[model samples]
Target: MRLTWIHPEDLIGHELRQARQDGRAVEAIARRWHDAGGHDAPPMAGASPEPAPERLRRLAEDLLDELATIPSPLADREPTGLDAVISACPDWPGAPLAAPGPDLAGRLRGAWAGRAAGCVLGKPVEKIPREGIRAIAEATGNWPIRGWFTARGLPDDVAERWPWNRRSAPTSLAENIDGTPEDDDLNFPMLALALLERYGTGFGTDDVAQMWLDELPAGRIFTAERVALRNLLVGLASPETAVYRNPFREWIGALIRADVYGWVNPGDPARAAVLAHRDAALSHTANGVYGAMFAAALAAMSLTANGPEEVLAGALRVVPPESRLAVAVREAADLARAEGDFERVLDALHARHADLHWVHSVNNAAAVAAALVHGAGDFSASVTSVVSAGWDTDSDGATVGSVAGGLLGADGIPDQWTAPLHNRVASTLTGFNGATFDTLAARTHALVQETSG
Candidate 1:
């Protein structure tokens, strides 16, 4: 059977027409776009008629007004650490031992497990409705399929299944089910794997930056904001031109790609945060950089400890206390304490901030909160909460999952999640392969040893 693929632009146009037929104004359309992290469409070159700036501005205002009215449930509270269950686990690994040694391998493994946990948590709920997600959690006795890994290994049927794209229907823009090209080009775990494979221990900051630049297609250029941020890093020259400015939210994908920096640094969460911040500043600003710092710090801490709460605390210390991301995480934790229902908090958040762009500080802030609170040291729950919450599902899932996987270690991941995936992941970008998660984890461990030594 031949497959039919519909372009995103066509889908957008169809939605707009349907909304218009239903008597919805352009403002409503604009609001939906903003909520989905989209900006106004750029004018097509050589078009004779163009939208008047004043008209577009009015549409933008209407959309903004509609957005301002929606209230988010978990937007107001302060950042709280994981619950007593996670804090009290006797087996929870503590902070890494100081300095250069073999212990780093264990830490890296923990961080990898954390990442895996995040992925597993989000995987099942990637595009499922909120109600459906809640129902699944209730039925499974686990909010997002947590902790089923047996040291003895997988059941025969599951172990024999081959990993490949199984979805049979056309995809919606909101749901890139099979992780096609249209999905965001880079995710945290994939980027970490790439960095480790490419830079390894011998490359310094400059070499890493150059390699990243080289990796991009020749016709594509880094934005001025990215350049400015890159200049802030170690060994990169600070350009006098000032031509570059920060992209802030638009470059979040690039910012979260800093986990490898932390992985390389091992026990030095602070250093990892610094390197992540410097790298992130090249393409992002404010919370964008902080998100990278948070992920990187967790990855770094994971190198030394398996305690999710402690690793999270280490990450929190690195970001600015007053930032929106910090505020959102704290609020989510508080909501988790006061309200037992995770969906209610998510509802509240949507009501308050649904109009905000998906990549904006507030949106990403909610993602962080969802991952930290829902996951609460349980790998699956964390990933599920964030991914099911929607918005940037893959990006959030990848980051949170990677961090959780790192903390939990590969051995801790349930066979169910990994068994179906068979450790395969794909990116059109070079220097990556469709390898098993075990192989990737082992390679990552080796890289840490090489870098720290």
Candidate 2:
């Protein structure tokens, strides 16, 4: 069967790479493909339409299923503590700082508002090519991206060459700004809030899957989530849904949905991570799952941790010591420390993660770490840097914004970012229409007080 979202060649190539990673011999499949006239699926469909190539492709597709069934484990150390989760890399080389005072309401508001503002900031540039995002920003006097982007004063040619994300540009750009728009980033947080309100920490993967089916529109989901939703409709189970024909399992979808779990479990990164894992398990596995856990833990830590660096160590503590996502986060943080220059760090991230898909967790997680390191806990600096660096723009912005927001609290976020959001946010979530950040924060703080207290 053909996947609507993936190119046939990409699927074939991806499976082969995984096969290689597993130390499985692809000699038979490789030779078979070569013997059948290579990767093309024979475009011509008329009489004598090549059946051999199609057959070869089918064989490859089936072989991946066979490979998926066999468990190929990695030899890596398990996590023990917050220090050096992976590679036993030694805990972050810094003394711990005092936890923040209990100002739950303010921190929750900051997280919600920051997430909204950051999402709008990156929306218009979501799929803009890396260079195109830079060119558009530079042309519009937004280079180094200090604040929200404006489409004003653009040459027609430049504007045409790097057009804004058609769906989001009208509202997201600076000049056209209004109240916060409905984005899945915010919607999932709302949904997570609903999940916790109903099921508390006892919620399971099936609960998450049910929440999507009940409240989320089919079109509202994407990547692994979309695939998993489709799987549920066909009567598949939780973990199975995550892998069934889902090439995007390691993408950033789950990570984007993680903040609420963290928000509700302030200063408890491990518990926050556990909650995130249940939600993430509905549609992701391995690194995809780990990314959500890391973000959730980061947000939780950020609520009380003294700084971004300390929060990052707490974030790393949640995931396994042996995971690739943990390694990438550390490497990105270490790289930022070593390089010092923001642009160089961005370039190195791209170079290291070039082989993965544009939305893969590894590089994007690195981008987040880089932004946190470079931004040095400044709200505007981190949000702008991650968005400008541009891989999965909106996701990075929301993630960074959430973490930074928790650290700063509502009063600490710059008025420039918060004012444009106009204290209004939209969502597809049921009973959450036209919600304000203040309202969400109040509700979240109430939940935390009731549950965690």
Best by TM-score: 2
Every model: Cα RMSD to truth? 11.6, 5.0
Q: Estimate each model's TM-score.
A: 0.60, 0.87
TM-score for model 2? Answer: 0.87
lDDT of 1 by residue, 147-213 (tens): 3212123334432331111221122112232322212223344555665576654444454456556
Give the count of colliding residue pairs in each prediction.
44, 2
Q: Which candidate leads in lDDT? A: 2
For all candidates in order, the CA lDDT equals 0.49, 0.78
